[model samples]
Target: MAQQRDTAEADRTLKAKHRAIWASGDYPSVAAEIIPGLGALLVEACGVKAGDRVLDVAAGTGNAAIPAALAGADVVACDLTPELLEAGRLMADRSGVDLRWREADAEALPFADADFDTVLSCVGVMFAPHHQAAADELVRVCRPGGTIGLLSWTPEGFLGQLLTALKPYAPPPPPGARPAPLWGDPDHVRALLGDRVTDVSAERRTVLVDRFETPEGFRDYFKERYGPVLAVYRAHAEDPERLAALDRDLAELARRHDRAAGSGPTVMEWEYLLLTAHRTDTSP
Candidate 1:
């Protein structure tokens, strides 16, 4: 019983840390400015039709949920951080879309079993500390025949390279937390979903990102606005040299991945995995 209590406490602590990390940065800006189209893409991929019941797990600022609601689906956006949910709620209201925003953990969802017709995440649930727990919750909450859609950054993509470049400077991952990019691997996702889902379809898609004309510009943007990146930079606030090294590393990565012609605009394709499967049963 004491061991169980300790574990639970630790889990709470970890979750709190995650919430703080996300709330500390201006993630709403990043979501709105950089990857706004990803949400619409995932919503279309999930076949989120009108009147369908949908749940967006780990939804950050309603990136996917808002679009799903805009499609006329009855959507609920849940996330670990309330700040993001509140922002999303306001955004949805402004858009004249109705959707519920709830603060819930992806690994341990607060919804009932088989409650949703379509369960999806877009570059969201991949950040869950416990990947299997999140996957199981996704399967558990989705009704049989409901679609399970995920859009995540591929391990070989620009986002993946960006993460790799940051790894050397970032703090070690917390215990039990897996690398977020692994969700982009088809085999990894398949293994997690296992026999609970059928008619699995996986596609590799790329989104064009031309947010900055220079690699350094991109790096600087992330440093100030993105959550994870800001957290790492915050950690090195007292150490200018370490921060400078990370800046160089990230800029170099962006330069290497940039495919722009004549330096007119920085064109980089961020590869992501789009996996859609039909839930079969609740059997584990």
Candidate 2:
């Protein structure tokens, strides 16, 4: 009972945060920084073809789902937050692509055996409290001879430094935070797949980071477009003192990260791994 209650509370809190952050238009641009590279790579790795059924896990705002659908694959996009799904639906419509948007949990997928020809997730599985369970769920829905493709961020270089700079204002994240969505250590993915797959491999790619156009852009984007950070501000209900402090802290951080507007685009180096594995039945 206690565990269920805690989970419920956390879900509510995270949902509220996610909704608020995505409500603003600033987030999509911020997300565009990293989404395209990951999305493209996953699509290529999945080898989606016309008429093939594809499952996009944690499909935030249809970044990957939109492109895959454009390629003529039948696509199902699933995510935990309704707000994010709404955004994705809007994007899909704008792109003139038909994508089935479903609200579902990654750890417990609502699909049947061999339901999809390919399973793809862009920074999705890592959110599962039980990585193995979620991974198993991913493998479960894929056809016996299908492909499983996952995209995860590797925390290193400019990416690590940038995230470190922004960490103070965000929610008190769990300790030792690696990258999110696909947050687990690399070994965990290999262990989970076991003998279920073959031709398994992982690689890195650079994502173009474009959230802040200027120092002021950074301040506004973080304050208005970041969910967990705004959650912290929401927590200060009726407390003017804390609000001022948070504002001051964010201001300082913005100044530190801010560079001249025409100083050329600042790119955050994100090492993302595209893991590809084929079901055992399909392999020679």
Question: TM-score winner among the candidates?
Answer: 1
lDDT of 1: 0.91
What's each prediction's TM-score? 0.97, 0.75
Q: Write the per-residue lDDT of candidate 2 for residues 1-284, one digit (tens) a residue.
A: 99989877876665454445545445555465535556766887789888889999877776778889989999999987777788778878988999899987776789887799989887655544456667788888898879889887555533334445456645566433334534423565778788888788776665555555554555556666655455566677578997777776665654554443348543333456678888776321
Candidate 1: tens digits of C-alpha lDDT, residues 1-284 = 99999989999998998999899878998889989989999999899999999999999899999999989999999999999988888888889998898999999999999999999999999988899999999999999999999999999999888877778887788778899999999999999999999999999999989979788888999988888888889989999999989888988888888897437667789999999999996564
Backbone clash tally (model 2): 0
For model 1, the superposed segments whose C-alpha errors exceed 4 Å read none
What is the C-alpha local distance difference test score of candidate 2? 0.68
| lDDT scores in order | 0.91, 0.68
Listed per model in order, the count of residue pairs whose N, CA or C atoms clash below 3 Å is 0, 0
